[model samples]
Target: MAKITFIEHNGTEHVVEVANGLTVMEAARDNNVPGIEADCGGACACSTCHVYLHPDWVEKVPAKDAMEEDMLDFAYQPDEVRSRLTCQIKVTDDLDGLIVQLPEKQI
Candidate 1:
């Protein structure tokens, strides 16, 4: 299982042990971690699951595709370097301690 820590805008943190192969959005939704609306499920069509990965963990994740990059452009809280759609992030054994921070709003 990968242990994920989701830090909310207000500094509250929620942590969960997510199963490998599951998307970060799925893990957040399943564990009731706030700030990850996952409005489009895990389809990567919506930017509602936007998150900011910790700087150290950024290089560990795969590069974002053009489509995902486009969707992120519509994110309410955009950060060119750290913003990401959580629905596109798959949990893996190597990501055991992934840490992500949620934006103030997803809309």
Candidate 2:
């Protein structure tokens, strides 16, 4: 399992242990971490689960695919470098201590 940390725009943080084969979005939803709306569940159909990766982890996580890149356009105040859809990130041992920050609001 990976210990992921979800940080709100206001700095509130929710840390949870997520098992492998699950997406980071699942961790947030299951743990009731505020800010990740996950409006489309894990289907990648919406940008409500948008988040910003901690600088230290920018290259550690998987790269975005064409679909995820496109979906990010709909996220609120997306940062070209840090924005990512939590659903697109799967949990793994490598992601232990993963940290992400939510946007001020989801779009």
Candidate 3:
């Protein structure tokens, strides 16, 4: 399992342990971490689960795919270097201490 931290726009933090094979979005949704609407239910079809990786974690997680990059365009205030769709990021031992910041809103 991995312990992921989800920080809301206002700085509220929710840290939860998630089993491997689940996506970061699922972790947030299951733990009721506000700001991650996950409207698409972990599908890459929407950007509601968008988040910005903490600076220290920018290069640790798996790189975003073409579809995820494309979908980010629909997120709120997306950052070219830090923005990512949580649904596209799967949980793993390597992401045991992953941290992400939620946007002010989802688009």
How many clashes show up per model?
A: 0, 0, 0
Q: Which stretches of candidate 2 lie above 4 Å from their native place?
A: none
Q: Using lDDT as the measure, which candidate wins?
A: 2
* Cα error of candidate 1 at position 98, Å: 0.6
Question: Which parts of model 1 have CA positions greater than 4 angstroms off?
Answer: none
* Maximum-TM-score candidate: 2
Q: Assess every candidate by TM-score.
A: 0.97, 0.98, 0.97
Candidate 2 vs. truth: CA RMSD? 0.5
Better of 2 and 3 by TM-score: 2
Let me know the TM-score candidate 2 reaches against the reference structure: 0.98
Off by over 4 Å in 3: none
Candidate 2 per-residue C-alpha lDDT over 1-107 given as tens digits, one digit per residue, 9 for 90 to 100: 99999999999989999999999999999999999999999999999999999999999999999999999999999999999999999999999999999999998
lDDT measured at residue 67 in model 1 versus the true structure, 0 to 100: 87
lDDT tens digits by residue: candidate 1, 1-107? 89999999999999899998999999999999988898888788889999999998888988889988999988987888899998888889988889999999998
Lowest lDDT sum, 10 consecutive residues, model 2, at 33-42
lDDT of 2 at 91: 92
Looking at model 3, the pairs that clash are: none
